[model samples]
Target: MNIRKRYLTLILIVAIALGAVGTYVGLSVFAEDTSLNNSGFANSDPDLIAELADQQENIEENMGKMSKVVDAFSIIQENYVEEVEDTQLIEGAIQGMLGSLEDPYSVYMDQETMKQFNEQIESSFEGIGAEVSMKEGNVTIVAPIKDSPAEEAGLKPNDQILSVDGESVEGLDLYEAVNKIRGEKGSTVVLEVNRPGVEDPLEVEITRDSIPLETVYADTKEKNGKLIGVIELTSFSENTANDFEKELSQLEEQGIEGLVIDVRGNPGGLLPEVEQILKNFIPKDTPYIQIEDPSGKKTRYFSKIEKAKGYPIVTLINEGSASASEILSAALNEALDYEIVGETSFGKGTVQQTVSMGDGSTIKITRFKWLTPDGNSIHEVGVKPTIEQKMPDYYYTNPVQVEEPLTLDQSDSKIENVQIMLEGLGYEPGRTDGYFNEATKSAVEAFQQDQETEVTGKVDEKTAELLQTAIIEKVQEGEDDLQLEKAVETLTK
Candidate 1:
């Protein structure tokens, strides 16, 4: 990613999803390229135009900056430094932009990548089945796909790739890293990995093999002193709707009552599959998603959201739940009024469509913004769980100190609030001691120093703002689902 700054990853995917083809049409004040019909799809069919309009409006509502992306892309296309293949340039632009955002969920997929992705969703692909990715500028393992070649290679999550076949891939593009790692079945791919708690990256190798994908797995568990039915979905793959039907039958066979769907750490798969999955729980003929363009023109995509038999439902999500996950959650939240538990979902609510060019290359463009049936845009601001879950330290990487000590120690209530929050997290403060003594002051001071706030040891408004660091933590501590749980507990009534 030759990124100047980390912009939103959704934006990059979105821009492509909208119109990755033709040319880079930068936004201009007037019709600068009058010959090209800057009106953009003005002559397209009514139905397509309607879809585009809805997408535009949804883009505005959720992520505000997309309005300018077209303009920038158009301008860059017209006047880039060097002449590059139109498709390559566009793909490069998307990859570069998404790379800068540093959001792992936001990504750009060229034709090959897109095909691999679609294949993964359909649950049938021939290759090593490891969920590989880049982290901290190095190719790292997210998870070895269940029984894929990468898993067989003994790869684990968080294993960083150092080299491929002894060729250093230290500073390589994501696709470049993937290109090196993926190959014909039975071909050997060697990788050097840096594992967690390990001082340095190490080397391991794997012989690629055919990878098969599956969807819709079910099991039973006991929660809240009741035997609850649990459905774990690895992806929204093709045939999911049929697979879902089979699961419904199984649930009926078991006479399951309550439902707990675990979509933790799931990266999106197929849209049709997600739509069907959601339809199983959502209301029939209800618009699962509504999109809008800049002009407020709306297009609603209906979900087959019909409640299956009778079941009290709860959907679980986490940081890795994205794209298709968002779609499924939106459908359930809109249709079933189900409660969600776990962390804030990875916000990837934009629609991506791939257009194949005459050549082997293709373009993935951001076409529309996806919204919940209630008209809530889940783009930048993701779907917040009704039951927010506080994860153990193993789950998240804390970038900012929840509370900085009083930066301007002498400022307002900043230091005091931080002390209070620390106590809230169960970290002992210098007593419930309200005073900003050495201990209280130290916590406040460290936060303040880290944040580059003034080091005055006083609790002020800035400290209060800083104390808000614990807000997510507080919410995650199971504050979102109190009412729902109460309702479910008394269902026997």
Candidate 2:
């Protein structure tokens, strides 16, 4: 069989989870003109034709050496104790080949998985609305979409999924695990997640819902007597750039003096969407980004804008910011000398492109590495903020899971988390240590009284639920957002 005939078209670089609404940290590049025709080389360029001939000769030579694989397949199919399907054999062989590459980003998608992926691109689907990626042999959450069920359930970035609905996902690939997570609308999927710094695995129940395509949110803030425009980007979807432009125009019309571009929990999406957004800020004098091919060739991309924005701009990022988020933050910081405030971003600097196998299946392969305008690759090393600022300690505390009432003298990690939450809520929990002291009891009693619950100085199921609800409400209110305050302060100063 001619190997070249198997590959039909090249798709995007971003890996979209069949279960999730948007893609994780990576740019999407669609290579339509690079498809090969029957005669090879749709463009009919002489150099491409020569390259194709050379590649075909190499493939023929490799095919001769692949006789051992053919023999193994024949043996498995004909000499096995039980009958095996030909499709299974073929797919297993393909998966084995990809596994040999040892790159988790490069993966095979069966026909059903590919169909689901295509459907997600055209319209929203029912799922737990989060972007996940395989990290170190585990399916890890990159970021939950803003206003998503996952976010609402308190799922945070880097949470490793150990099982789905009581079934272990130990050996399943990213897409397989996603298949288990995806379901119809209003169906609850229980996820067993292993979070960092927590000794026990927590069970998270999320009701799947139809994820919307609204990726950009706009608002304004009055800080230090100056009207500051705030535009929060959840992901760089197909229409994100257009929506951002419209919101930005509206903010400008409101006579804002400073601007804050917030991408704290954005996972990332379409490459062109971010590139177009960058064009509005980055000047033509400097390159916004660089793409390095496998052969060490680098291509620099620059914006056409001649001047920068009239007002000072500050970018907000955190550990959940990745891919196109990193691209935008790095460009604004390195190319335009803007200030970046918050924690370091999630590092993801490689690019992937999907190749169709002509049988409704596809393979996404890592093809290139992306670099910042300063020629820095933030792959394992994420982009550092110019002014680093972390959220309150309670913000990183795990959810309070109480099987029994945690009373006085109880020493556990759950108690420590409760102490942190109590302290953050303005109650004086004398010690943040695991050992629950009298001060903690008093603080809990005070909290219970304030919340109109029973004055039991213990953390029961009701108290835990109420505590988590109160904290979530506080966070959503954005009243204690120190990072945003710092960004506004920087602009005002």
Candidate 3:
């Protein structure tokens, strides 16, 4: 009786608190939950609020709807075609919900899923351990977990995971794909890989094993007569925080000079991981990012740990540099004055939070927009490199160029730049060279015609200036490029 009474009291308290918060925010209890249907305010009086709730209103309607779903599930479970475990049904329902969200990062984890997730963060997981990532709407492998089953089976980065055990991975997200790949130790997980520069989708069977994930790869080398440490961070996994610290200590031991932090294809894993990494560069008490809720309540992520003691650092970014990569780069560039080099970063500043919906389903929503230390938005506005360094010549092997009539090729820097511009404006360009190449000239002619210029098969200084202006306009359009987006918490107490 005591326990039952306590549970009811707790429920009543929770209900009261939720109602109070909803009222405070002026969320209309009388209106539909849809953004377009909201009335912006709620009616006063507890009785009125209770009456509105009792009328199967808003959230109550949702609860009632959910109750119907569970009741249906219960009925189905009692009279199904075959005997089914409740847990399996629940897991399937959860997976379906996550799939509906279309968010690869968000997942509803059962005990097994939670165990696997924890292993992925801890830098160890069973089965064919491949670092699953999304590229061009396909769940791809960034790289096989180093020395894991996938790596041993020759799974490389940029390998598209087409199918797992004959099941197409087309609609499966990273989590679902991961769940499919993971199995009992010594079990075989067949992955159909669509590798670039390969004619066929190669099938590779890997025996399950505990794969170790090394997030931070650091090496010391003498480049240009300067002792430089190149650190390649694959992802911001939980283990990366410790790995980064170890590397920092090693750099200190080696008498740190110049550091090249490589975050080329790192899809951000954990927010806290990036926060900890930033602590090495960001000053104590320094702002990192601001998370804003739906009701416009803002919370700041500050640099809590003392800044990591270091030297001249240069962060190398590329199109693949995203989430945590962008976060770290923005923090270093804006707060530490560290040089940012290489290509523009992937602009992903929205923070996502996942909630379990009691009915075995989950909800993952964009919860906040992040700002850098200087309170700059870092979403569409990617951190611009301090020094623009084109990809090295050696890295270009048969690099395609834009086909322009009466022009050289993509090797020409101007044509290459023009191609980059076209790519930015949702056009395809073969190469990014500065030559008056065939591809370049054709692209340039079209671009000029669009701008009411004479259709000349050439890229003159005027066209170049126009391209620059277009790039600038894109940056200024609230794309969140504050170097990094950390908030100042304006007037919030």
- Candidate 2, residue 415: lDDT: 93
Indicate which candidate wins on lDDT: 2
User: What is the C-alpha lDDT profile of model 2 across 1-493, one tens digit per residue?
Assistant: 3332222111110111221111211111123434445543345345545654565455545555556666676678779999999778877877888878877778999988888766554457679999888888999999998888988888999999999999999988889999999888899999999999899999888999998768889999897789999999998887889999999999999999999999999988777888999999989989999999999999999889899999989999998999899999998999989999999998989887776665568888888989999999999788899999999887887778888899989899899999999988999989998889999999999999999999999999899988987877677677679899899999988
Query: Candidate 1: TM-score?
Result: 0.55
Q: Which segments of model 1 are wrong by more than 4 Å?
A: 1-118, 131-144, 149-163, 166-172, 184-207, 222-227, 284-286, 292-298, 304-309, 377-384, 388-493
Candidate 2 accuracy as lDDT: 0.83
Q: Mind giving the per-residue lDDT tens digits that candidate 1 earns over 269-380?
A: 6666777666666565677667765466778775453544477777777655777887777677776677777667766777665554433345455556677888887775
TM-score for each model: 0.55, 0.89, 0.57
TM-score of 3: 0.57
Q: Write the per-residue lDDT of candidate 3 for residues 1-493, one digit (tens) a residue.
A: 4454344334433453454444433433433343322543343445544654554345444444455446555666778989998667655765676566655555565555555666676756677866665666788775444446665565655678898889997876676677888898889988887767544566667799866667887887663455666677877887788889899779878875766777765656788788877766777766766676667777767666676445667777765677778888888877777778766776777777644343333344566777777777777567777766654232222112223433544245435546766666545455555455566566767777888877776656566556655554453342432221111110011
Cα error, residue 61 of model 1, in Å, equals 30
